[model samples]
Target chain A: MTLDISAIRKEFPILKTSIGKYPLIYFDNGATAQKPQAVIDCINQYYQAENANIHRGVHHLSQLATEKYEAARGVIKSYINAAHDYEVIFTKGTTDGINLVAQSFGKLLQPGDEILISQMEHHSNIVPWQMIAEERGLQLRYIPINERGELDLTTIDELINNNTKIVAITHISNALGTINPIEEIIEKSHKVGAKVLIDAAQSLQHTTVDVQKIDCDFLVFSGHKIFGPTGVGILYGKEDVLNQMPPYQGGGDMIKTVTLEKTTYNNLPHKFEAGTPNIVGGIGLGKAIEWLSQFDLEAIAQYEQELLDYATEKLLKIEGLKIFGTSAKKCATISFLIDNTHPYDVGTLLNQQGIAVRTGHHCTQPIMDFYKIPGTIRASFSFYNTKEEIDLFIGALNKAVMMLK
Target chain B: MTITEKEQGLIDSFSIYDDWMDKYEYIIELGKDLPLISEDQKTDENIIKGCQSTVWLAAEKREDKIIFTADADAIIAKGIIAILIEVMSNESPDTIINAKLDFLKEIGLQEHLSPTRSNGLVAMVKQMKMYALALKMK
Candidate 1:
């Protein structure tokens, strides 16, 4: 079940574009994935053939859209191996999803109740909880990360107590590429009756997620990061938990009945989806998931692991290049800084050679605070990314470093 | 040589980027065309805060349109300011106030601009619009 890299490369049209006489080498998959023809065509097809609103009119077009939209939900359920379609709630993206939980769940926590979050959580995951904690007078606790960017679960007993209401952590760090042991975290949190939310924004593309096996209370991921359209995401909650939580917003679709006095809420998913959902994006996400499912997940993981190995070896060989987060278990993301060159200058120089990489704090400023650096240049990889692209990236980085020196 | 009507038209039409990949290169070229500001205008009062690159912007009102002058220490930032001025400058105060500058998203230029750069761009635009709004209030 080896991956066919050549065949996969053919699906993304942007790979052919040239920049300054050099072909574009994209290493920014952690920020967002390059869309394949299938996802593109799915979006175009919806606009061309089936451009209509869903769950509204009793007409043929409405029914057709409703069917497609629900089918997409089914696709997501199976993709994550969830037990039911009702458990999957569509969101604007991961940010919106976390905020929804923060606003709703955070309201329920009493004063002095603790909300434990790992230092490696993205700003999207951290800020929402912080805001909630501030508003409700709950204490926000941070789980420390070692120099390797791995969460030090050694102090788990000290962090989780009866007063701890929720534990939020990232499955794979976008900056350090450290893959956190989420199952262990969830199990420990549950022992004290605390709910857990896993930010799977980075891991969803690289690994298969089985919510049942992990037994997390809630999980969130963005669609765009997994070869789907932007502005669409998933928030999965266990039925009992979702059913117990109050609605985050009240609007047309989310309400069963509305009056000036009182409004009855809809069921699990629609209760959270307040306004018109991104119908086209949901369909595109379903298509992207289907396209991704055809490939062998294990092979994809192994190939990316090999690429990470090769990249780490090559980057370490370059003089004065300092790699961040040297963990045993990591995804194919490399965050580094070259000696005496600002990350912005490094990014700009690489762009001239048509090598795309993200530079800066990566929206994890606290992690930057921990590392005591302004920022690092991050090059994240995906399954379709090749070793040649890594070689090109390394070559450009070397040239950039030499010019700066 | 005086700036011509054709040149103004070309600058106006340049707002929408034809392709995103070529935008940085185009911006660098635009930076080359920008007139250098006098040393007097590069004071602390003109400096735009929160930009990774040092950018200084100054504005004046002429013939009911807000005229803006800007310079950046960084070449690409200067080029970006040049493009922004081309679209925003010399328009009626009311027109500038009402103008929906969707050019960045349409041209995919926002994707290349870092969030801080994007915020600085927004701040510049907001400052320009605020000038128009003040004129309208008067």
Candidate 2:
């Protein structure tokens, strides 16, 4: 591998930690990634020297914090290649971003307009649209997936028709690791004059995502999933669309002037940001993205793909083991179930060997229902992971299967 | 044996295995031997939905003692329920309600009993005690 795997693992402090008796082999990057010392130190340094409220204070600390926080927004703008800095709004996480769009931009939809999502969407993406559809008297539809867990785009023309208002889809499936054909989806959605929102919660960490290039109207992702702290995220929208939509929350920072009878909303990003936000989370998210930028994302993507291939090969060797996602394009995640064995039993056994994996429907119950299984044991890898760790995981998985069987 | 005596016996039995895999193997064996609930009793009302697994529990009062039969989709959960049934079944209502079940920790099965694990063991235990309290009132 071109990337030094040993040096990369050293950057994460939790890699050195022991779970019970064994050293931690964290294969749960899909759930949340471990933070590097750089991100951790940046957070600590912020709290130590420059912790203050932003945008409202005129003091020295406030201005410094504001400058840093705004600069962080600029970093995110460039990272996603958004046209304007003000188009990047700070959010709680991906869920919050979707809800913001559903609540605010959703107001523009009339009765009988359709919101098309996918069968592979996480619950966050599904539920918000459902709620908004019910409220606005809009029809909700889903794009189905094939047995390979890839989206079945044959019905795209019928799905994204003239009545379709917005199409919200994940750039990658969190449970199945299917990197979706987002560009194609966006092109089709826009052809029918429908706005598109890309949920990049799983894709942002693994590959490079450019909103401008994709021409998606909106994109959202979480900070913690990208080696940063939790509770902070980004919502990028085209400036014209964001200016057209109403504010999601009405509070101190979101309004330009306040009268009991009538109030005007603030500008683009500030209009959506209402309260005292996660300042530290925002700064840390910026640092996390900066830390990630040091390494070429294309290189990380290649390394992670290699790990996925190696793990998939070793896992398929086990008799009765079936992987859920087998798309030609995939990320470094494998969700599998052994013959007649419950995922929880195998996951628990793997945990005994200190191999951390996610076991459940992964908030994508439709995918599980489509596969006719309750859940699958998912092992997701990162760049820091090595082939040796994959060997250990394979050994542990074999023992788990043997014991369960 | 009384509940406490049965717990001590289980702890003694588990003490024989020094390795983690050995301990899990024994649990798997116990899972194979779990006192399964009747197929008719495996209804919606009896199902406890944990985040990771599904558990079905049935409790009946037989001659002033509570008889518990439980099943879980997951083998580890089934094994844990087997341990619980071994200790808590065929015990007096007052005894079943008051049992602390500390031996689970001593046997390293305590992690399964955690509310986070939610394999339905905790909920099943609480439901068992609730049945006991209801039967006593009756």
Best by DockQ: 2
For model 2, the interface Cα RMSD in angstroms equals: 1.1
Clashes of each: 0, 0
lDDT of 1 at A181: 89
Write down the TM-score for model 1. Answer: 0.80
Docking level for model 1 = incorrect
Residues B68-112, model 2: lDDT tens digits? 898888888888888888998899999989999999899997777
User: Which residues of candidate 2, in runs, are more than 4 Å off?
Assistant: none
DockQ computed for model 2 against the true two-chain complex using alpha carbons = 0.82
Q: What's the distance in Å from true for residue A138, model 1?
A: 0.8
Weakest 10 consecutive residues of candidate 1 chain A by summed lDDT: A396-405
lDDT of 1: 0.85
RMSD of each: 6.4, 1.3
Candidate 2 on A267-324: residue-level lDDT in tens?
9899999999999999999999999999989899999999999999999999998999
Task: Find the number of clashing residue pairs for candidate 1.
Answer: 0
Please, what are the lDDT tens digits per residue for candidate 1 over residues A39-110? 999999898888788889898888888899899999999989889999999998999999999998887789
